[model samples]
Target: MPGIRFSAQDLAATRFTCSRLREVVAGVQVLKDAGARAIHLPWVRQARAALAGVRYELLSQLVPMPARYLPDFLSPMPAATAPSLAAELAALTATAPAAVRAQLERLPRPLPALVADLRRDPAAGLGRLAGEIQAFWTAAVEPHWPRIEHLIDGEILYRARRMATGGPAALFDGLHPKVSWQDDRLTIAQRRRTADLVLEAGRGLVLVPSVFIWPGAAFEADDSRHQPGLVYPPRGVATLWEQGAAAPPQALAALLGRGRAQLLAELAAPASTSELAARTGQSAPNVAHHLAVLRAAGLLARHRTGRTVLYVRTAVAQALVEGGG
Candidate 1:
């Protein structure tokens, strides 16, 4: 199992971030899966149809197999709080020719001619690659980004609460079955081989929660050039692709009006008014009215991020949903 040995300094410097670039990179893998493991994601099905006209063959060739170790230049550590896709694509375009060749040389198998061309003229090659990525995002990701962002934000909030209440160890808890934290060492169970990394001052672990990298976790700590980080799937991902609102329990539906009760039940995971309306087949105005009523009653809480307002069940509401109230 590969383990990251955090010195006292490293532990103190560890931090968490929700990276846009990382998500884009991981999303490519999800597309490559072709709904095999991500059977639950109905969005993937739609995305595939949307992307049917794009140059998917070339894009998939660049990503290759063993999707974990993608070229670092393509998805560098995000620099801003919320990096725009343009910014991430620019980073890919900026890769030096030599660096691109170096990464290609490290691939386990012989490089395809298209990829080898990257070594000859990195700027042109990377530009083409960036265009492919943009096309993919526009076709497969942009339309679904709001729902995806909501899920990511909810995970971040959940982790923040875990850290606040239980400290560092709590942060590692339930991250993945293969990951464990003990005696200041963050261990990741790996099949290939064993390795250890000691973080120096100013070099901290970046914890990134991923929606696409499901059923397993990945650790990358050996690269001295980049900040070490772990990419693990966020909780509640199984419900990510669920198509429509489930029927509320009969008793609960009878107690609260069916509309409000259905909204409450769906609030088990955070969702915006638009998302709720889309899921429930209700108009946005109607959804907002129900949400406001629930919020006034202390059954739900509203969180504003950017221009979007997300609603989640409060403990009182959760109890009600669970049939306790």
Candidate 2:
């Protein structure tokens, strides 16, 4: 079992951010797993076909095992509230040669020639790797990013509410079956490794929510070089790739007309017009039209977060959904 002992300062400094780099890294593991562990994620199966032509052989070799050690430099912590994929690729490209060499050296089966080239001209080596990552993302992730982002955003929202209402203990509770909270310590159960981390005040812990890191949580706390953090599967991930529209109740459909009612029912959680369209198998224009009607009718409300507009059910909408059901 790996446990992190949090100090008062670490608790105070703890924060959450969704990482595009992490998602890409985890996707590598998913691809290597060959859909065994991620059997429930239909998107993973779809991604495999999409990424067949990508030159991901190197990444696949790097992450042969899911729960094993992965090079830390591959997925650094996000530097912004919602870091874009391009920004993350740039971060990888900017990684110091020494750091890249260090991580490459740590690989169980190091590629001697690749390591030599990276150490010789770190910028060029890392630049090529970053380009590969960008290609991988385009083939395997960009298409499904809206749904992925919604899952991550929903998890962050839930964690915020937990922390606000129940403090750290409440938020940590049930984060994962293997995770336990007591005595200001966060313990993560690991299959073949164990460590105790004592966090310092200024260092702080970063809580990252991952959609693909299922079944177990990962902890990274090595010296002062990288911020201590845990990457755990977010809540409600079981339905991440569950297909088909959320069918509206007959009563609600009759009352609002089928298209509008279906849109409202799908808005049980916050979603953008594009996300709604993708999930409900409707066109974006059609979804936007229904959303406008619902908003005008007081059944939906839109909130702007960053560059995207997310629509959520209002109190009346929730009541109607429940009553109609």
Candidate 3:
């Protein structure tokens, strides 16, 4: 079979790299050389799991890490392309379950419109909004903590880059990647392992399914969006398991301290600095000071709404909340 032609829509549709298209072609040859019969694409894996009627846990190991390497191809697009859950729920309500539909109704309505605005105008400054929605989902899923962790670990196994230089722990610690369970398959979307913006997973042609390919890279929807997507060929595979050996108690404390706890509790709903202050019972200025500190820590972020700055916890922050570490 001939290779698929590339286009801008393809670039935006998926999340992996196209610059190394030749490498992908070569990798496919290597896969065929290895005597593997039918190759399982990323989406196929996901669909298989969904058909099982249970969400299969992907690479959960990587979920604890921060999103260190985001694709630079479309940095200007919103971090999340899909409109807010509220918006998607409204669209899917007719067919969605009552429980799921109710969950969607709980979200703020304007969130999706704001996301669209950010997508259409890069300078709209919706990063904070993105952070808030992400936080909300993180917090909302606490009841399903075990399942989420399993999904992340599954994603790690599916997408974690197999490094020749170090073991899984070292590579995981060093890279600090994000893993997710999409369509019931675990997925690891590549991020900058370092400042170079090199596609770490793509470089080795490992079994790491390129988010850039099939389902495309699932970024926060900031830029790098295209359709008909690009894919990275598989090579070696690394497993993402739960962080087996626990870190020291102090380390855990630092991760889920008073500040993070307070922030997570408040971010259940998007709130401005003043609103957060009111909720925390702290003076507005004092609340503002802490908000700034949290944002710098990447635990909380800010968004502009009208004349005020809305603050919310980040996914990492919620991870700490969920992990209690």
Give RMSD to native, each candidate.
Answer: 2.9, 4.2, 19.4
User: In model 2, where do residues sit more than 4 Å from their true spots?
Assistant: 39-41, 110-121, 191-193, 246-304, 307-325
TM-score of each: 0.86, 0.78, 0.24
lDDT of 2 by residue, 1-325 (tens): 6688887888888888888778888877766675565644677678878878788554555566743666667787765668888888887887777777777676665464654566678788777777778888889888877777887776676666678888999879888888899978888886544667777766778888887777567777643566877889887576677677889999999999988888877765577898788878989999999999899989887767668887877778989989999
Candidate 2: Cα lDDT at 282: 89
Clashes by residue pair, model 2: none
- List ranges where model 1 is wrong by over 4 Å: 5-13, 56-58, 250-257, 283-286, 296-298, 315-325
CA lDDT, candidate 1, residue 154: 72
Q: What alpha-carbon RMSD in Å does predicted model 3 have with respect to the real structure?
A: 19.4
Model 3 misplaced regions, further than 4 Å: 1-260
How many clashes in each candidate?
0, 0, 44
Candidate 1 has an lDDT of 0.76
- Candidate 2, residue 192: Cα displacement in angstroms equals 6.2
Cα deviation of 24 in candidate 1 (Å)?
A: 3.8
